[model samples]
Target: MIKIKIISSKETYSVRQPVLRAGKPIESCLFDGDDLETTKHFGLYFDENLVGVVSVFENKSNNFHDEYQMQIRGMAVLEEYQKKGLGNFLINQTEEYAKFQNASLLWFNARETAVAFYEKLNYTIIGSAFEIQNIGIHYVMYKHL
Candidate 1:
């Protein structure tokens, strides 16, 4: 069985490094605000091994008028576990957490390749695509709670 639960920012680095950073150093997986008191990290465990990870931060975007907003960062699932509904499950849990925190919306700089995935979840793209150094193109995507 697969279980999704809250985990420490440090714990998320394992999956984040391998799946998101890939060729980059493990330290690159450490995102800003990851250890903040209001930040939350989630891990997807299959049996006893973590296979996916995601982190959310209490961040506000000028593009959004919501009083409370959350940003999702460093979301990644193991390659072998991709397309098995795990991504959807993680996202659903994150949305619930956001709502619990009184956040009216959730946003993220989603990679260009993942745009369709977020769109399928009812998130709309904002502004044009842009590059982030070594990372490929990305677009700001958001969903209102």
Candidate 2:
């Protein structure tokens, strides 16, 4: 059985480090606003082990004029768990939570490879592709709630 629930920012680092920052240090997973009062992290647990994680921040983008918006960061699922629908499950849960928080939209800097994945989920790409210093190319993707 898969269970999804709110988890601490610290707890999310375990999955985030391994899945999102493989060669980098564990500290790389510690994102800004991760410990903020309004920030929320979701964990996907299969049986008792956490297999996927995503962090959402209550932030408004200049590109979006919406009063309330949320940014998804460090979304990752374990390599072995990739094609099992856990990613979609985590995203659906995040959208529900964002709606509950009164956010009008959700956005994220998705990796270029994941653009099609987000598109399939109804998120549209905005602006040109850009690099994130250490990371490769990424596209800004968003979905209106």
Per-candidate TM-scores read: 0.97, 0.97
- Give all candidate RMSDs, comma-separated: 0.7, 0.7
Report clash pairs, candidate 1: none
Task: For candidate 2, give the lDDT of residue 103.
Answer: 91
Q: CA shift at 3, candidate 2, in angstroms? A: 0.1
Please write out the lDDT profile of model 2 over residues 1-145, one tens digit for every residue.
9999899998998898887788899888899999999999999999989999999999888889999999999899999999888899999999999999989999999999888878989999999999998878999999999
- How many steric clashes does model 2 contain? 0
Candidate 2 vs. truth: CA RMSD? 0.7
> What's the lDDT for candidate 2?
0.92
Displacement of residue 122 (Cα, Å) in model 2 is 0.4
Output the worst ten-in-a-row residue range by lDDT, candidate 2. Answer: 13-22
Candidate 2 residue-wise lDDT at 81: 91
lDDT (Cα atoms) of all candidates against the true structure = 0.92, 0.92
TM-score of 1: 0.97
